[model samples]
Target: MSGHRTRKWVRVAGTAQICALLIGMAAGGCARLPYTTQVIHEDRRVVVTLQRETRPVPYSHPVQLRTDELAAALAGFSFREKQRLPLRWFAEEVPPKQIFRSDELQAVVPYLVEGLQKAAPDERVYFQVLAPGMNPAYEKDTTAGWIALREPYLHLTLEHFHAQFPVRKSEQWDLRYPALPPEPKTYLLYFEPGRFWETDPVTGQSAVQLREFLKIAIPASSR
Candidate 1:
């Protein structure tokens, strides 16, 4: 069975010579099949990867991260151009930016963490992470939702969103395609997190759509 599985797996995709040989061997000879280079993006807040043999890690105990620590962990949840490297420009709607601001997070994270520690099984900690607008006093962006205790799978979901030109979006605005929201407005997400989490074959199982302009990682540790 192991050998069968391994044989079914092609370590590296294909080589030019191998492709030509396979093409020559084909019954009807080679024909061009149109392919799209466009990348379909999954906008999600949290992404979870599962391994066959690994056990799921759930948040069961009280977890407290210092403002800086929470800030750092948040970096992974946000899109990082440098990390995407050569693929930087692919299918990006807005310039990559961390959704929540550090100072603003300090305001809510401590309380959220406190809730997490005390939450019972099946209970969730609700939070609204905010970021100051580029103009600080004027712009205040929000990410309001709840997070459950650590589980094998991700559970971060964006429920209701109604705001114009989120602070992070404004900060990342370098004359980007999306015109900034003229005013604060509530908009329904194309995909609801809870429904997407439980349904959708690909996303329901292994794939997660990233949103919040954003989990578990050693990131923005600098902040």
Candidate 2:
């Protein structure tokens, strides 16, 4: 089972690598290629943004979703260390760039379907790939493309939390960093939680447990 998951991850990573090549060629303005590729994980609700290091610009659309609907969906996929949920996701692009070859694209389909079937089989999963906004250099100018592009990010809405609380006067001293030139300092936090699997009501799915992943949504405070 572990081998299967590893293979799936490798395939996804390979797709990303291929897309990177397509982006390079398209941005180069080779009429022969005529297009660039972008990846969108609809279920993850994120569009991978690509850019050159020096010219940092938003070359893609923001990942978005209905917050209300997202919350309800998340509630159904309860986090447990022992559970393994299959997820369905995809890649797409605007201006029609062929980032993936037939074989690569074919490789992705099953991986996604299987993942989704295991994670949220009954739930709807969507995907799209898009080219980002036109770069100034590549605006009307056809020449001067082909540059080193950064690695596209895999945007996943794994999980996040928000905690609200008032700090105590005594604790305020510890929060300040007088030794660090009055600049604010942040400390790392860690959490250990027990996990187990329960049947999901919305999708009627099950997941395998590997490691316990935890996030401290709301931190406890004495103040």
Candidate 3:
């Protein structure tokens, strides 16, 4: 999916409950897919790999990531780019209905926060919650309440952010999913390190000061 198309879906996902239905439909089908998780930590970046296993789906279940383990996996990296790497891996290996339903993956959020706190104690961290389909903006408390009630796949992202960032104000954007190009993209979550004014004194108009820091791009293949 092109970044443009993905954003459009996200806009739609924000309003409609179709994704839940799609997930349900996909889950009802047979043929389980194999997936792998890889976490790479470097000086300024942490790359998490959730890809398909080349081998067949094993009879053994994948282990769930503990909060501390998830945190440790993401430790010492900054998501400065603010892009949700496309979930093409899910599309490639798993059915759409099964896409966001992996408890093993969903379980990583809180622990990832724990690891992030240790990795960058003084720095703020953020994770993207809105998928290809999600409402552009939602009231913080209302969104939180809805997530608690709905307990959708997106709750993984939202719950983690609520635990870590705590701050209510934020800006969201659609960015190309990293790695997968030309077809699929994903949502990016961002953390604000500090507070800034959304209004411009010079123009007496409201604008997002932090938006300048966001990265928006499409892979050459997708373009």
Query: Please, what are the lDDT tens digits per residue for candidate 3 over residues 1-223?
Result: 9989987887676445546656877989845543333332212112232334334322112223244333322221122112233744444453222112234234435533443333221122223332221332422211110010010011112222211212233334322211121221232232232232234444333222322322121233532
**Stretches of candidate 1 exceeding 4 Å from the true structure:** 1-67, 79-93, 129-141, 151-155, 160-223
Query: How far in Å is the alpha carbon of 76 misplaced in model 2?
Result: 2.7
- What are the per-residue Cα lDDT tens digits for candidate 1 across 157-179? 44323232333342222333223
TM-score of every model versus the real structure: 0.35, 0.16, 0.18
* Model 2 deviation from the true structure expressed as Cα RMSD, one decimal place: 25.5
lDDT of 2: 0.27
Stretches > 4 Å off in candidate 2:
1-60, 81-223
Q: After superposition, how far is residue 39 of candidate 3 from its true place, in Å?
A: 22
Better lDDT candidate (2, 3):
3
Deviation in angstroms for 19 in model 2? 45
User: Is candidate 1 or 2 superior in lDDT?
Assistant: 1
How many clashes (backbone atoms < 3 Å, residues ≥3 apart in a chain or on different chains) does model 3 have?
A: 19
Worst 10 residues of 2 by lDDT: 141-150
Best by TM-score: 1
lDDT of 2 by residue, 4-114 (tens): 897687667666766876899899875531232322232221222222223232312232322232222222232211222231112121122222334423333333333
